[model samples]
Target: MIRRLIFAFISIAISITIASSIKAAETIRPNVLFIAMDDLNDWIGCMGGHPQTITPNLDRLAKSGVLFTNAHCAAPACNPSRISVFSGIAPNVSGVYANNQVLREVLPDVELLPKSFSKNGYRSTGSGKMLHYIIDAQSWDDYFPEPASEMPIPHTLYPDKRPVSLPRAGPWQYVETDWGALETTDQEFGGDFTVSQWVSEQLAQKHDNPFFLACGIYRPHEPWFVPAKYFEPFPLESILIPPGYKEDDLADLPPEGQRQGPNRYFAHIQKQGQWKHAIQSYLASIHFADAMLGRVLDALDNSEYADNTIVVLWSDHGWHLGEKQHWQKYTAWRVCTRIPLMIRVPKNCPGLPEGTSSGICNQPVNLVSLAPTLFDLCGLPPSKVHDGPSLTPLLKDVDGQWPHVSVTCLHNPGDYGLSDNRWRYIHYANGDEELYDIAADRYEWNNLAADPKYADKLAELRAKGPTSFASKPEPSIQSLNKLTWVTLGDDKAPPSRPDGSQFPVFFINQSEAPVKLYWVDRMGQPKFYEEIQPTKTARQATRPGAIWQITNLQDKPLGYFKVDDRSAQAIIPAH
Candidate 1:
């Protein structure tokens, strides 16, 4: 009886000790303040990307933390880049390579960054454009503006009349490409301003558990519409053209690069003499975003969680302002790949006893590592499923020995831009390549791939790239924008006005009967492409301004959809 009592006492003691230790660990786990900026390039005061750009809050954040000067996104578009960050999976592996690709449809079983935190005893909440305009509702415990809306963003003022400053050249022009200042105050303007206020309120209050708070600032993305006060510093006359722009930049490029450059949007902006005005508007938007960031920072500093929280700021991807002869993103270039990444850890964290030291580190890093890094810092159990390695070593010591290269996947599979410490190599599926010594030529004005001297270096980077690509999953037709339907008696099928690069267009037949698909030729003559049966979809290669007409098996006209610049689904609605 004495022996049995001793053993039972020991067992109870062991169980109590284990439970107490677990509780202690739960108490010290750091809260995460995650901030994301949309379409923001390296054009901040600390980065010196553009000399005229001003970002006081961004510079302040960099001064108190470790700034990653050579950080790049996993992908160059909004949806894929953000998906990579949250899921810790690269676009090549996830098969989500464009803005049109939905995250849930692509990787439904994946545990997102916020969801991971929530599972491990943290409250995950966010507001404003966190996941490609949708809230990714299931990942968070609570979200500002409510997750039921599916849009976390609050209302902001825009010009009552669209294309306020830049006139649309044609139907091919993106409507959101325009820019101007709105006559309103930050409070009155709302939008991101409202997002910051809600996030700030959360920071000021006490919570039951450690929180993972995300604040997404959506500006510098498009339309450039902010309060007029933000635009005062950047006058149109003082605006200089992008320093990376060169008149003959495309001359040394391969045929694929040549075709991708010189897009219609840039041509139209230059033709309309709105290049300087556009630059001015972009600068203003950056400044506005910075001010909003300041509000959130101030709230944190005044709160009780200031010294215990881990702060990380990042952009989804970089933007291109006529760089490499390209106007926007979606190009395999440094300007579109590199982004701003910063992390500030308070003293006595689990991963780093001393916390992060303030300095800039030039080592190449990708945003895909964010999830793993946060898990390490918070003392959460390590997950083997993440594609990216933990960044804890770099966080502990900025100059720690590291052997990793950043990879930025393009819109198509097997096409990627890889960056090491000194060189950038772009590999396309067509077997074409671009090599640039980015250390010397930051602008990437010279293409060194054709030179025999750099052949060995090109091969080295190519070997490090992704060997296999996941087949891109197709988005459901119900998720796409419905094209306007016109019956036979209503209107005639428009002529095909094909222009620009070609992309796939999906025709979804929702009618009860089978429909015949035809491509209207330039002269308005219908040419049969294929037949799409009911409840079926057919993919066709088409270009901007192209027209596709639908008809019954009896050859009666039904409706037609004019193809835009991007890949979209056209619904053949039932009569």
Candidate 2:
């Protein structure tokens, strides 16, 4: 009888253990597939802004998810805008004031979105451009480098190209057209191929671990290169020109408010009177990107992960195709500031009704809110320091009154703008201000800043302060040139040590004046210094082809040194 009781007790214990394990297995974390597009505007069929553009895959995704129609970027430039989204910190606060500003310098201790996920045992992987011009290697567990050439073929076949050129300011270069038989699909186009393939492999692995995969598409940014097949859909003659520009349109804009200039491709079109052809190229590029997106979505559907994966599709910022005579971003116009954002949560997630789609929410939303929103969705703790608020409540109820304002900042000169539900107010550093009822003047052709009736409204917006409101901490000077000795040769010849354990650093003379040397970690963190000089008694340490940057006062490149080989090199100007 005692033996019988022991057997029954053992069986009960085993059952309890099994039950606990089963309950743990059932608690699966939802995976995230973050896809970002460059310079994509409200041209997709899902947005209903462009009539002919067919983004069926995106449309389907939106139908299954919540689409935020009024999404804007904290900054319109590539680096600042992307930094804002990824870091959840405002550009002004983060000190990422411009394209060249490194994010790690401002938030050294802050873990990036992917890094945070990785820390919590989620597998984080990405390919192509995500962070900025420079990818932060420390953020991702795996990163596939972008291809060197962003072309369908090696080079253009037609040498004597007769493309038109438009009058513009800023860096616009021209190139002749070259055709080749290397007709690869947009999926296999250089950098895109690696990203698409990586995503496919990740899905195929079907690991028990949850994954965070981000694919950054670089098309629709410049050159507008895509397969002829995609181009065939948008015939040159049928391509609609953007709303016509009138000379009086500039009447309301300040001198600085005028459109900058056209890019090389648009300039070529204007010179050759092939504006329709240029538009066709752009549309073709967008179509190609959309098709790439479709391939990934199809892969998701085929995989077991589809039902549980949360898909978020966002564009870094919008583009301007001759809207108000501008051909690129970096403007306060709707075509430049307004971006497309779509979030498709898992069907089983709370709040959203299955297959329910919400119409446009005209309330202002910025990309800076993306980090917090993702964290809230994934049930992660958000960082205490972020400029954006989560839109989870709004997603739960479409009519929820989650009213907030969005502000976009332009760098040093301090031109900034504020957008409420109905109006947009822009203020420049020179004390010039403009106000427009965006509901009525989406084009911003009429400025009400000078009107006496709207003085209160202007004050309300301008009271928010300059775009660059955050003050940067003073840089540390002592840690600028401090170095530790590293081994030179593989031989065990008593590792050479520098005097006072400090290594001698050399500065390349790229400029007529002396250079400033700063030390940054692999994560793109910056340490500023007044100047660095080689100590007479200090021995230079040998390191790999990394570890140094030499720059002039204006922050122009001077040279770099390979730490492993102790070799120095100079940077030459590209003619």
Candidate 3:
């Protein structure tokens, strides 16, 4: 009996010990407060890219952590850059180099950062625009405004009538590229402000497990419409043009570089004399974004998890306000590629037991390293498919040795911009190159690729670039190709002079009744294809010049669409 009792006591003790160890492990695991800013360059006060910019919250965050001064995005465009940041994949390998390309379609099997955290026993949650215009619900445990909506954004006020400040230059100009101040408050704005509020609520509560909370702030982007109070600090009369601009900046650039510069939007904005107004609006929008960030930070600092959470802040990519004679992103120049990156690790973390000290690191780093760095800091297994190395060494010590060169993928596969500590090299797909000694010329006003003395340096940087680039994935038939609907009058449908390569055209029947699909052949005669039910969609194989007609159930003419040189969607109008 004594032996049996001793054995039982030993078993109970072992069980209790195991439970305590597991509980202790859970308690020490660090929480993550991941924050993302959209189209935010180094204009914050900490980086000083623009003197008029006011970002007290951003500056405070920088003072509390390690700020990477030479960090660049994996891609310059939003869809590709955000995809690379979240997936730990580079745009060159993933073949997603543009905003229009769908993420799941291109790299369907790749696990996103939040999903990886969730898989490793963390509660991953987020709000606002984490992905390009999407929330990507399956990757998170729970999201604000409901995850089922698939759009993480809450309702925000926008201008009732667009083009409030800058007039539409042409049909080719993006509609959202306008700016003005709105007569409203942060509570009335309700976009990123709402996102911040929800995130603050999450941070206030205690969680059962470690949390990976992402707060995405969408501002300092386009349309630049924020509450009027943000614009008070930056008076229109005091607004200044970006100091990087020069009339002869493109004179020494290669053919591709010269061609990419001097865009029509900049010309139009200059012609309309709205340049200063645009700058003021941008500054205001940035101030608004900073205010939203302050809310989240305040919540975290006041919460129970304040001392144990890891805070990381990054932007998807930088924006251009007439830098390099360009107006928006999609360029490999430093103005568009370089972004603000800051990480603050608390004590008791696996990667840095002593925690991170406040300092700046000037090593060239890419955003693709973000996932792996978080994994290392949070004690999770490093992803097997990460393209960039972990940044834990730099986080631990700001001046740590980093030999990595940051590469920013451009619009195509073979085009890229490579950056190091002292140089910036741009390579276009058509064999044009531009090299700038960035240390001497921060604005990239001079191209030194043509200089024979730099030939060896050129070769060295070129060799460092990616050797193989995956071919761009073919666009799916469901591409967002918009077609204009011409309501039929007393005229007949146009002839289909079917020409060029064939592609699929998706037809959506948005009308209240069923519509008949007809192919207008070369003879201008309607050939019946099929009947499309209301609120249904169909695909039709068509050529570049093929004409399609839509008719009511009684065979009455409704509208017609003349296909362009690409596959598109033709929506039948509701009567």
Instruction: List per-prediction Cα lDDT, in the order shown.
Output: 0.89, 0.65, 0.89
Query: For model 1, how does the per-residue alpha-carbon lDDT over 1-575 read when each residue is reduced to its tens digit?
Result: 99999999999999999998976754588889999999999999999899999899999999999999999999999999999999989898899998887888889888998999999999999988889988978999989778988987899888888878789776577879999988999999999999999999999898999999999999888978999999999988899998888888988999888876778778888888989999999999999999999999999999999999999999998888887667888887889999999999987678766788898888899999998999889888887767888888988778888899999999899889999889999989999999999889998999999999998999999999889998898777666666566566667797988876787878989889999999999999999989999999998888888888899998788889988767788888997
Which lDDT tens digits does candidate 3 get at residues 1-575? 99999999999999999998876764477999999999998899999899999999999999999999999999988899999999999999889898878888898888999999999889999998889987778888999878998777799999998878888754446778888878888999899999999999999887998899999999987879999999999999989888787777878888888787778788889899988998898889999999999999999999999999999999999988897788888888999999999999998887777789989999999999998999898888877889998999998777878888999998789999999999999999899998889899998988999999999999999989888888888667565778999999889998887755687889999888899999998999999999999999999988877889999889988889988766688888798
Candidate 3 runs further than 4 Å off: 1-27, 479-486, 489-557, 560-567, 572-575
Candidate 2 residues lying further than 4 Å off, grouped into runs, are 1-27, 105-107, 146-184, 244-247, 259-269, 347-360, 464-468, 471-575
Off by over 4 Å in 1: 1-27, 486-498, 504-541, 546-560
Ranking of predictions according to TM-score: 1, 3, 2
Q: Estimate each model's TM-score.
A: 0.90, 0.73, 0.87
Clashes of each: 0, 13, 0
Worst 10 residues of 1 by lDDT: 477-486
Candidate 3 residue 546 C-alpha distance from true site, Å: 14
lDDT for position 294 in model 2: 79
Scored by Cα lDDT, where does model 1 land?
A: 0.89
